[model samples]
Every structure is written in structure tokens, then in C-alpha cells.
Target: MLRDLSRPIETGMPTYPGDPDVTLAPDATHGADGYATSRFRTGTHAGTHVDAPRHTLPEGEAIDERDVGEFAFDARLVDLRPLEQREAIAPEALPDPGAIDDDVDLLLLRTGWASHWGSDRYRDHPYLTAATAERCRAADVGVGLDAFGPDPTPTARGDTESPASDGDEPDGTPAHDVLLGDSLPIVENLCGLDDLPTRFRLYAFPLRLRGGDGSPVRAAAEWDD
Candidate 1:
């Protein structure tokens, strides 16, 4: 079976704190121009997007610099749902190394947070700790999630302050630091994991935007019936 794992790009879709707001405007009317085109302005990370090493590491590789094969993921979905608001996803929540297959190159975290995609609660979605990101790095796998990012997002829109709760404070973008620091891709704003099998093939190739720190992708997944 095949399923789309991407969030549709539209005007006014929720974006990360301080990121550019998305806009889609008609550039030419069908009646006037006899052809249609649109003018869209959006941040590279807006909507369902992938993060490249350049997203965090100043010396890291941009999305267009990496080999396209890396974007095709041999993915494993790990469920960690029912978490509390703004909860941290600790390393222990991941499956043991023994349970992982050598063929897996990406780990998609299912926190059941996609249900809150457009609400304020979406920003409060569960997040991965630096430790969890380290685990994925050591395991040689990239990270994906149903929420905004692997790191805790600020609950308020346009707030750039790092999130703090229960006495744990992440250095800004720690998960991105650990993962992208190593050139591992981070996919975010994914949806429909609840309908996918544990193991699947994921394709989320980004546009060949030269020197792009990141890019929005048409992410999709497929699994044997």
C-alpha cells in the first residue's frame, strides 16, 4: 500500500517559530493571461520539509549538495504516542538496537501529534531530547516526526526563546545540532503515520535549490500489502 506522508502546502499553514509565513497568490488570471501561475513566498522549512546539515551547522552540507539517494529512506516507524503536552521524548523510549534492522536508514517518530497540526497545541507537541538524537546518530539513522521538530518548539508563535520545563533546557536546536551536525537529514511535519506499517520505503526528495539550507518535499511512503 502507498500513502502520502506530506502536509499540503497552503497559505497560513502553521510554521516554526519566527519562520516566514507562507503565502500563495495568483500571478496571472486565466481570463487575462490564458495561462495560470502562482507567486508563493515561504521559508525553506515551511510545511512538510527536510532539514539539511546547513540548517544548523555552518560548515554542514546544504540540501542540494547531498546525493539524492540519501533522501530515499529505508524507514522504521517507532510509536511513542500519548505523551503529555510539551513532554520530552527521552532516549529510552526508542526501540533497542536489537530490534532495529541494519537496512533501516531513518527513524520516523510517531507521537500522535499530527492530529493537532493546525492548533496551538501543535507547538506543544512531544519532542526528542539531545540524547535521543544522539542515539539515532550512533545508530546511523536520520530522524523524522509528526510534529514541528525533534526539539521542543516554543508554545507561542513567533517566540524565539528556547523551551524550558521540568528543569531541562535544550540548547537552541540541540536535536538539529546532533543530527544535522552529522549530516543526517531531519524530516518534519509528517502526517498519516497511524495508517502505515512499521516498516516502509520513504521518498522525500527536495528541490535542487542551490545552497539551500533546507527544502520542502513531497514526502510519501509505501509498504508491502
Candidate 2:
């Protein structure tokens, strides 16, 4: 069985704070031209995308520098739901490092935040604390999530329908410092993880952009039917 875990890139889609907004404009059409083509413009991290270590570290590897095989992984998903909006995910929320299967190279956390896509609540999704992130690295697995990023995407005052819960201050470079600083890739803005089997092979291939700090990806999952 195969399941697409990527979020669609469309004009005017919601993007990370301060990131470029997406736009799809037509450059040619079947009616006017002999072919149909459009000009696509958006930030590399616009939708479902991969963050190469270069996203944070100046000397880190670019997305194209990594081996393509790294895009595919023996993945495991953990459902951490019933979490409050903008809540801090505790380290205990994840499985103990020893319990992780030996074959698992990627760990995905499903917070059900994707359901709030296109809403103000989307920016207020739960985040993984730095401790939780360190734990994942200790487990020796890359991480993915259904929310924005592992760290709290700070909600600007009056930016959402409701205020962020108290103590929602952003943790500077929390997850990224631990995960990406260790040269591990991060897959963000994933959707449909809830439907995937507990164990599946995840593929999140990005465009082969030269020296790209990141690139949008078509993330998918596969397992026995």
C-alpha cells in the first residue's frame, strides 16, 4: 500500500511565519500557447519540505549533497495526541531509545495538527522540547512531524484566533540545534500520518536544487498491502 504524506503546494497556501507565500501563475496556456505551463514561486520550506543541516549550520551539507538513499527510511510513527495547542512535548512522550527497532532510521510524531491546516490554529500546533529532540538523536533516528517544526513556531500576539497558552515562548533553535546540528534531516509539514501503519518505509525526496538549504518534497509511505 502507498500513501502520500505530503501537503499540496498551491497559491496562497499558509506558510511558516516570515517565509514567502506561495503563488502559481500561468506563463502559457493550451488556449494561447501550444502547451500548458505555469510559473511556480515559493520558499524552499513552503509546504511539505526537507530541511538539510545547512538550514541552520553554515558549514552543514546542502540538500543535494546528501545521498538520495537518505531520503528513504525505515520509519516508525508515534501518535502523541490529546495534546493542548502549543503544548510542550515531554521527553517521556517518545519511546525509550532501546525500544526502537534496530531497522528504524526515522521517527515520525503525529500530533494531529495537520487537521488544522489553513487555519490560524495551524501556527499554534504543539512542539517538541529540546529535550525530546535530544532523546530522538540519542535513539539514532531522524525526525518528522505533522505540525510546523519540532520546535514551537512562535505565535505572534493577535495572530491567531486565540492567544497562545502561557509559557509559550519560543525555544531558540530547540529541535533544530539538536537534530540538524547533528547533520540529520528534518521533514516538516507532513500530513496523513494517522492513516499510515505503525511501521512503513517513508520516502521524502526533494528537488535536486544546487546548494539548497531545503526543498519541497513529495513525501510518501509504503508498506505491505
C-alpha lDDT score of every prediction, in listed order: 0.88, 0.88
RMSD of each: 2.4, 1.3
- Please, what are the lDDT tens digits per residue for candidate 1 over residues 27-130? 99899999999999999999899998999888899888999999999999898877987888888999766678999989999999999888777887888889
Point out where model 2 deviates above 4 Å.
Answer: none
Clashing pairs in 2: none
lDDT of 2 at 24: 94
Residue 89 local lDDT, model 1: 88
Q: Residue by residue across 1-225, what tens digits does model 2's lDDT show?
A: 899999888999989888998999999999999899999999999899999988888898999999999999899999998888888898999999999988998888999999999888898888888888888999888889988898878676666475655865555776887898887769999998776889999999999989999999999999998
Model 1, runs deviating above 4 Å: 157-166
* Residue 72 in model 1: lDDT: 94
The weakest ten consecutive residues by lDDT in model 1 span: 157-166
